[model samples]
Target: MMTKYKINCLIVFISILFLHSGQKPCFAQKDGDDIVIGKYSIIHSSILDEDRLLYIHLPRDYEDTQLSYPVLYLLYVDIYNYFADATITTEKLGGTGEIPPVIIIGVANTNRYRDLLPAKIRGRNEGGGADNFLRFFEEELIPHIDKFYRTKNFRMLVGPQAGAVFSLYALITKPELFNAVLSENPFMNPENADFLYPRAEQFFKNKESLKNFLYIKCERNERPQNLEFAEKLSKLLESEKPEGFRFKAEFKEPSGYFIPPIPFGEGLRMLFAEHKLPENFHTNSVKDVISYYEALSEEYAFEVDAPSHMLTFEGDKLSQQGKTKEAIELFEFQLSLYPKSLNALMRLGEIYRRMGELQKARQYYKTFLTIRDTDVAMIHNRLNMVERMISSSAACRIEQEIRKNGIQAGLRKYQMMRSDPNNELYFDESEFNAMGYRLMGAGKTDDAIEIFKLNVKLYPESANVYDSLAEAYMNSGDTENAIINYRKSLELNPDNNNAKEMLKKLKKK
Candidate 1:
């Protein structure tokens, strides 16, 4: 039997072959329309005293959802379309969830030599502007992109040759700026090598942990000097062996100065190897997996949720194994982390409906409708069936009472109607929150405010209830009440960033 690594390599090889074979040949391509792969934007760089062009490739679902993604900044993009293509394709075909979607930003260069070299050599006139370039990149380019995009704090920088030298410089000087560095065929001449080796030694000498991924690749036969330099650098990094820093070096066959697609793909795979969920992972181990990645997120200073698809897959497996409660918990956790996930809502709706909980099913189905616009016939049929079931259910009558009278009065009536000890009246926090939102959407601000206030009274310990009440008050133009409720919500749940931002905005007003 092949090892898992070999199996994965085979799959990637096949995928690359399939992609290449499926695409139109280079010479046979027709130019009827512009073959646009990404968008172009210009940023005025105050550090460089000039404007720079930024080429950005957003993921396919970027505009459809409010999900934040990691960013990949590629240097020397003018000659590296293959690298961009590989990255994009790998992300698109995220087979085992190893490759998460990323926003690719290719920094087009105006003066490659000047931007890549760290310092001026004896005879080089077009170099020595690397410091200025890095300043422009760190201060102007990155900030502008981050402000305009829904981006995670995670960043990766990829470069080749002299650009790779620049990437190494950044790794030694500003390790916090990027979470990963992919250096391909670094032109580590004596001058560049001497400058960088000292910094690397000093950086590691401090006994500080460097929590990042570094992948360096060089062709053995391309240039003897650069290859030797790459080997020495790799050994030095291994010797220091900073904790939490993952280092990998590959000496490939001669491929000239270009970074071959195979190494590029492998580098990315190595960088995100821990991102994929194991095939044997079950519901019991889900928490452990989440905890592991959560620790990684803390170490890397970014928010990293388990891939939604992997969670859904595991939830389905658990549900198939007659583990309904576990499946429900898994889906609920997924929704808690990614509230905008339509799949999680749909799964919860299906699970509740299968379990004969019509009210909960209807609630989740309705929530799914609010988030997704896809008109699946099966979902429509299930939603219709759920609505019909709810109309004839006893819970419907209690909700009607709540709408007609008030929450307290409705609860009193419900208790009187169901006098048995086991037949208790149940009204969850989410149900009330949903009802309040519906009323708010219908322009009944006063009624919505009442409902939300009642929810807050019923579930005072729930931070979400307070957040809902705060939102309702904010919508009603009651800034004081909104600020107070938002503050209360934030006090209860300090991680409620939405509440904190709303409070800030209301206070500014």
Candidate 2:
């Protein structure tokens, strides 16, 4: 019991335990998994002339994978390590049959109030640093990410709370940042809400390529102002006839992490939901909206793509107009007729997953995965489910062992780097995305928005950014602005039914 070998081993074990315990546990713990957290700094803001420190999360497979991966950059609080634990935890929890495995970039705030505010300010609460912050994101942060990681052009952004407000500003002021945006619990000042809608119309008045996704959520715990603001945002987005914007919105009670799954997932589903794909949806919002557009095409003696250019004046025309069952049937029929259609297969898979038919969802998702050559942002999440469902003890053991060693070894290095204050941490995009979502949960909206906008600029070809920006705008009560961005988004992808619906509502108001 007192041998030197045993004593040495005991000391090492105790040291590891102590170090791990001291590390923050922001996320919930799985049975045998660990989250790697670290911090880094860069000169991101030119106006402020200050170094900004950011937190990063590395996923379980980050070190294991050599293939280039897509990135999701998340904005967070102003502090160097604020919400660091929460960010890691949220991503871990969301990975379980919820969202995707993403790199999280948590930007710590040196001056959140200054950087996130869209207009000039005199008081501490008011901010005017938005433009400079935007510039920093577009020029420095994004380029840094591209250079430092094995990243494809595909990217997404995320923000929450006041960060959602800042995100809206970025969406309207500069629409060419990221391909997709995910925003949670935005703050919509009444004055700001009024300013949003008209600005939206102006932004999208000129036709532009707008392939983006905007996913927004409003928690019910806040004042009536929040809900009312969300409604206004919905109206504004619904009015515009954008081509590529996919907008999905919902109001729900706040959950602890990364927004609640019910509404947030629903929004995600709507924004990216696929239709039957052999006749793939176009970027012009013409072929992908709904049957109404198809019927209108014939009645107006217009081309099938006519709706791509036409302004949808009456978005509510479909209210109580179609049966859910019939809608499902049509989607299924399209898939049956066009087996190679990406949109159809994705929709079918999502529908099956939602209906708790994991097997059917797996089949469609597998098919989609084979054809999906671009970013598989949510692939890891799906893979986790597949692995769990396979029921192969050998396979399970192998994966478990790999994960254990991976997480534990990563944790060890992570602690060493964190302890060394002089050292910096490196991260890819998936880690950044998880960080962004965690920042949202902690009510750091401004930083999150900046992160997301940068993503849009980096990946202009993606429609997901527009969708994410629209959600951020809605949270901020900048419905007018949300609508304009949504229109711009629709311009990129005409098939997004969610954006079309939101645009119709905005027009009605």
TM-score of every model versus the real structure: 0.65, 0.43
Alpha carbon lDDT of each predicted model: 0.75, 0.53
Give the per-residue lDDT digits (tens) of candidate 2, residues 400-498.
Answer: 332357433433543454466775343223333333343344455554454445446545665666666675666667788779778878999999888
Model 1 vs. true fold: TM: 0.65
Candidate 1 lDDT score relative to the true structure: 0.75
Q: Whose lDDT is greatest here? A: 1
Q: What stretches of model 1 exceed 4 Å from their correct place?
A: 1-37, 60-67, 86-90, 93-95, 121-124, 205-208, 255-259, 262-264, 285-289, 363-375, 384-509
- Candidate 2 stretches with Cα past 4 Å from truth are 1-35, 42-44, 78-100, 121-125, 205-209, 254-509
Q: What clash count does candidate 1 reach?
A: 0
- Model 2, global lDDT: 0.53
For residues 188-260, what per-residue lDDT tens digits would candidate 1 score against the true structure? Answer: 7667777777888888777567788999988877577788889988888888878878999998887654455
Once model 2 is optimally superposed onto the true structure by TM-score, how far is the C-alpha of residue 77 displaced, in angstroms?
3.9
